[model samples]
Target chain A: MDKALLSTRNLHRSFGGVHAVKDVSFHVPTGAIKAVIGPNGAGKTTLFNLIAGTLTPHQGQVIFRGQPITGHKPHAVAALGIARTFQTTKLFPHMTVLENVMMGRHTRTRSGFLAGMFNAPWTWREQRQTEAKARAILEELGLTAHTNETACNLPFGRQRLVEFARALATEPSLLLLDEPAAGLNIYETQQLSQLILKIRDTGITCLVVEHDMSLVMNISDEVVVLDQGHKIAEGPPAAIQRNPEVIRVYLGDEHA
Target chain B: MRLRIYYPVLATAVLIVLLHLALAYADATYYMTQITMSAYYALVVIGLCLLMGYAGQASLGHAGFFAIGGYTAAVLTTYNLRPYADAPFVSLCRALGLTMQWKDLYGTDILSFTPWAAFGSALLLTGLIALVIGASVIRLKGHYLAMATLGFGLIVYRIALGTPVLGRADGISNVPPFHLLGSLQVNGRAPFRIQNYYLAWVVVLIAMVLALNLVHSRVGRALRSIHENEEAAHSLGVNTYRYKLAVFVLSAIFAAMGGALLTHYSGSIGPAEATVMKSVRYVAIVAVGGMANLWGAMVMGILLNFLSLRGVFGSFDDTVFGAILIMMMIFAPQGLLRVPRLRALGSLVSRRSHA
Candidate 1:
């Protein structure tokens, strides 16, 4: 049996009087494309934050590669080979696209404050390799033409592409994407679906939070449907499509 | 370092050196003195660039750190609290053929430490203080961070005004210049001010190189990452809190070193050095230069301070700085370098209003 790359055990969290997440438990097997889908206010993003270590679970454990990371900070989780993207694009406005991608490579590199200030030879070598790596990702994603443009100036869809490239720069074993297709048009969405499959082809596991049901149904190997902070159903895409609870969660109870 | 990559720093250095020679040849030694003094403020502003501009940790009490540095150097270079060799404890040591660094000569105690020693200790002390303060308050964002630092500055100012051991309101005088190679001394000698001028610019040059390198390297990227979006930077393994604290400490050390240099140059230190307004003045200089641009800080810090020093604005330097800050926040928030962009924006707004 394939081992789980990431697993959450009995995760529970509450903000104020509202329970944002409740007794949520799931496992992502190695090299699987898993989709977590829901309507509004279903705690999908909160769940992503918990796994990415942005928010600590009120009760439960987040295990990555069989190691407990329940209360670790975001940077610690990133260092341990998990990378994620925000729903709203968050690129450094002043830096060029290449620079923004290179910024993501900062974690995987070894040049520290002292080495940077002094411009050590090893730092230079690492920087060259970093730039080359960033350029290759840009080229692969058809972003080479916009490599030197400031990230803030890119069009909305391209900005999303840049974020994907930046997240990929961390070379994570598992990538968590939040609302990756929230605003993309049909062509861009199709391109993104292809890219997600390509990423999975490279053996990187994906845990995607999405609102686009078509994209979710098309790309997901396994589906987890969430509604009002509870998991309504979990199974293969075909099984989830037929589940009455998930149908009721997406539609009205009368429609179900 | 690649000379090719550092063209700007090299060019700026040469330009400054040439400007110095031109002023000397034109017999404007007094003007040169004012420029040199501005360099000290420029040093403080550069560090503020790293802290506020790059790391996005706004501090309004940098003058407090400056005061701490000046006073540390002043007290160590001028006063002696410990009894000398002829005193009972010291005499016993001498009777046993042992010696201590703090010597008591016949009952009079004087400061025996070199100015360089004082400078080094002041730097270390400021780093330690900044570490504590930064660790405590780095999580405060925007105005809260500013207010916390402002309170710290005000407290330091009041303490300096009230403490007699720190010379109270009058401060300490006759701070000796640092000695190099055991014999040659560097000080702000009036009529020429040659040594002080070179020393100040030399430090500025090194600060610019280091600051530029820091802003361009991976650490620099991490800092810029935090500046743009703290949450995003954290998720990318930037360790936002640690980087903020580290940059804050580094900025404090720079300001302290500059303050110690100013103390030695003026040969006196005063409680006025700890004033809250002085800290805000530094923020204004960096703002006018450009946010997160190190060279802009150097140019604007030196120019604005020189103008104030030459009595161009009389006693209204504070007013001028305030106005500049407001204007920058409105018209040129990207800084002086982007004034053309601001003009374009202004025209666009005007066109919309006309329509």
Candidate 2:
């Protein structure tokens, strides 16, 4: 069997009198789209935060590419090829869209601070290449026309795409998206599903935490349903759709 | 190659050079002296602008670095002398050939080190101190960092005031003026004030260039990203703490170099020179200028320094500076640089009417 791209082994997290997440374990295989779906306050977002290194799990091992990265700092985790998007789009609002995207390329840059300050030829050359790459990413996301605009000035849907592009610019082996379809319209959601598939085609594993069942069911290769910080069901999309637990969680027992 | 920027910069450079030469030939010592002091003050303000305005790091401890630089020069110049003497261990080490002191290693009096050496050493020392302070204190967020740095400034001020070995409250005098080459007497000769004025201006100009480059680089972009959203910056793979510390150290080095230059130019150093009030004044200078624009700092620094030299507000310089800072914060937070758009609009109208 192919090695999992990212896996959590018995993950546990608690906050004073509340067990935010407990005994959760899942493996995301390479080049697959996996969705972690849950209701409000179900710890789906907290799981993303834990995996992304924003929060530390009390007891767990986050293995990425067969290496443990449980308690590393967020930037260090990002450097190790796991990138994430915030639940609320967190673009550098004052900077131009291109600049915001370029910031994601910072880790890949080789130029030192002194070289950049002096405007060395190599620094300029690298900057030009990064800008070109950022433009290409923008073009791919249909955001090329908005590259020069401030991130805050973009429409909310476009901002969402910009965040996705920014995350993609980090060249992550695994992408963890938190509520990528939260505020998106139907068309945008469709586009996002297409983008997720495209990303998977590029050999990047995806672990998406989302609420929109239609998008998740359509795009996710496997689904893990979370309810009140515990995994209710885990299976392929069709199996998850028919699961009694998922049905009861979504629709009441009377509707189910 | 943007003429809009290049033309003004070129014009300003020419004007400053012309002014320097004219003052050298004008035979007015007092006015020339005032210009020299103004240039030094401008240098401090430029560094302050970079720290507070561009990096968005609140530092009330700049005067601490400034005072340290001054004392470094003072203690080195007075080496082994009574009252302002070197430490006993250092003196003993120097005598026993266990270690070559900085003074002995250079083989010149503290005053005679080349301007470049002074500049480099001052920057190195200041950068080292700032690195230590920044690593410890930069983790504190917002006003806590500000208050902590303010406390540092007060502590440094008190050290300068209370320590007799550092000249106590009276400070050290007869700071050896900067030596150009080995033969050229830039001080105590014909047009000495003019020479010192130009020297100080050149340092200020270099500081401004460095500050400008820093603010436009990738580091600047990273700093702004952190300023806007620290968590976002981190998620994007920015080591925000490292960047903040780097900026803090760099800003301190610039301020220290400015202080060193001022010490040499004035031929004196004092505890009062690095008071908490002095740090506040530098912040006020940055505020009066626009925080977002380096040129704003340059313009305001020169303008305010010259205004004070001309005694435009007499003993009310402090009051005036404070009032300007408050008014700018309230009404025109962007400061005088924002008014240029009006001038551009006026010119556009005039051109259309003429056509």
Clashing pairs in 1: B84-B104, B85-B104
In the range B106-211, model 2's lDDT, one tens digit per residue, is 3543313344444566678878888888899998887798899999899889989998878887887665656656644335334575566666667667666666
Off by over 4 Å in 2: B1-9, B21-32, B81-121, B183-190, B332-355
Looking at model 2, residue A190 earns an lDDT score of 96
What lDDT score goes with residue A66 in model 1? 87
lDDT of 2 at A54: 93
Task: Assess candidate 2 and give its TM-score to the true structure.
Answer: 0.88
In model 1, the runs with Cα more than 4 Å from the true position are B81-109, B182-184, B338-355
The best candidate in terms of DockQ: 1
> What does candidate 2 score in Cα RMSD to the true structure?
5.2
Best by TM-score: 1
